[model samples]
Target: MSGEFDRVARLRAIFAGAHRGVILGIGDDAAILAGDVLATGAVLSTDAAIEDVHFRRAWIGQGVTWRDVAYRAAAAALSDLAAMGAEPRAMLTSWAFPRDVGDDVVDEIARGFRDAADVYGAPVIGGNLARAREIGLTTTVIGAAPARAPRRDGAQAGDVLWATGALGEAALGLAALEAGIAREPDAAAFVSRFVRPPSRIDAGRAAAQSAHAMIDVSDGLLQDLGHLCDASGVGARLDALAPTREADALARRLGVDARALLESGGDDYELLITAAPGVDLSRIAHPIGEITREPGIVGATTARTGFDHFG
Candidate 1:
C-alpha cells in the first residue's frame, strides 16, 4: 500500500470508537450521526489553520508541537459553537501536508484531535487527507444547539456589555514569541493563551440564558464588538477597561500600550455578551461596558483592528 493509505489506516485506528451520537464513524464513505441530537436544533461551524498564516512550523521544537497545532485548530472551530451556546456532538478534520510527512507526525496530530474532542465530548467521525505545499487543518464541528442561542443582532441600547476571561494575554503571547522572549519566566501565561485558547462552552450556555446578544472574542475585542454593534444597530461605551498586572508589565517590556493590547488583541476566545439590567452573569463574566443609543463605538482607542484575511 502507498504511504498515504498507510497513514489513513493508522488514523482510522486512532480515532476508532462507538459514539452513541454517531451511527457510523471513520472508515466509512461518510459519517452518519444520530438524528435526535439534531432534532431540536444543530449548529455547524468550520475553521482553518494554515502554516505561516495561523501558526509557524519553526516554533514546533521550541514551544509549538504537532499536538498543539491540532488542538488549536479544533478549539478555533469549536469556539463558534460556544458562541451560540451549543453542546458539541461531533467533528470532522481535513488535513493537507507535504508528501514527505511521516506516520508518526500524523499520529501525533490525531492524538491532538482526540484530546480536544474528549474535552468537549465531541467525537471525530470523519475526515479527508490530501497533499499540499503547506501543512493545514480545516475542522468542522457539529453541535446540539441551545433553545435560545444568542445572536449578535439582539442587543438593546441599554443592555450591559460583559466579557469572560482576560483580554490581551494572547496578543502579548504572540508578541513574546515573535520577539524570541517567549521563554522568559513571566511570558508563560501569555504564551499559553496564544498556544491554547479556550472554548467557553459552559460560559456560552450560561450567557445564552440571559444575554440579548453574544459573540466569541476571536478577533480583537473592539473589532468583534464592532461587528455585534453593527448587527444590533446600536453603539457601545467602555466604562471600566483595565489589563491584568501581568499583561501590563509585559506590554511595558514589549514597548506597547497595554490598553491597546486589551482593545485590539485577538485569540482570547472569551465570550462578549449583552444583557438587560439586573440580569446576573457574575459567575461567568464581568461587566465591561454598556450599549448606547449612539451609532458608533466609543470609550477606547483602537489604533488597529483585529485579524482579517484580506484586510
Candidate 2:
C-alpha cells in the first residue's frame, strides 16, 4: 500500500470529479475515452519503458532485438486495454534518444514500432521525437469493446478468482538474463516470455463477458489482486493448493521453486479475473481462488507484494 498505490491514491483523492465525460478513470487498466464503439466506450492508456528501468542494453541484441523492444513497449500498453476488453484502435509513440545514437539504430527502432503496430492493426500515429540522455519510449494505445470492458471495482462477494495462461515465466526469464545463464539451451522460452509477453487480449475480452472484475497482472499476482480487492472494497482468500504456473524444468534450471516464481514474478501480462460464482470459465481462464466478504487475502502460506518501483 506504500509506493505506487499511495501515489495513485493521492492523485485519486485530489482529482476526484475533476475529469468530465470519462467512462472510467485513474484506477482501472485503461481510462475510457467517453465515446461509444461497439456499444461500449473507447479505452485509452499510455505506458512508458525507460532504457535502464524497464530494459537493458545487454538484451537489445541478445534475447530481444530493437524491434522487439518497440513491440514489447506497445504490447505493455495495449495490455491495459486488454484488461478492459478493448479492441485496439490506434497507437502513438513518443521517443527520446541520445545524441550520438546512429540513424540506423533509430531506423531499426522505427521498424520495431511499425512491426508491433501492425500486429494489433493499431497504426503508428505520428508523435514527437526529442533529444534525451537515454532511450525513453512511450506508447499510447486506443481500443474499444462491444460489451462494456471489465472494471476493477465490479467484483461481488463470493465471486471466484481465475487467471489466463501460466505465470512467472517472464520473471524467470529476467532472472536468467541477469544471472548470465541466458545462453543455456533451455533459455529460449524464458527469453521469449521476458522479451515479448503475450497481451492476453482474447482471454481478457472473453472474461469480460462474465467477470465481475478484472485486472492485468503486470506486477506480481498478489499486488494486482490487491488492486482488484481495493477497487471492489472486498477481501479474498487464495487456495493454498492452487497450482504453480511456471515450468518445472525452468524452475529447476534457475534453482527456484516454481510456485514461488508464479506468485511473485512480474511482467507475465496475464489476466486476473473474479467472476460470478458458478460461471463457466474453463475455456478462457484457470481457476485460482475465491473472493470473500472479508477484506484481505487469507490462507496463503507466504505473504507477497508485486513489483513496485519504490518498494
| TM-score list, all predictions | 0.96, 0.83
List candidate 1 segments past 4 Å from native: none
Q: Please name the candidate that would achieve the greatest TM-score relative to the true structure.
A: 1
Q: Give the per-residue lDDT of model 2 (tens digit) for 1-311.
A: 12335534543443344323345555665455445442455688999999889888777656677877777888888889889987876666777888766655666666766666666656554455677999998988877763666799988889999988877778888888877777677877787787777767778778888889999988888788888998999988887643334367767767876666678788888898898888988898888889898998876655676778887
Question: Please, what's the RMSD in Å of model 2?
Answer: 10.2
Model 1 agreement with the true structure over 1-311: per-residue lDDT tens digits:
14767777888888887777799998869999989988869899999999899888777765667888788889889999999988999999999988777777788889989988888889999999998998899999999988899999999999999999998788888888877787788887788788888879999988888889999988899999999999999999987588888789888998888788899988888899999988989898999999998978888876548889998
> Worst 10-residue stretch by lDDT in candidate 2?
11-20
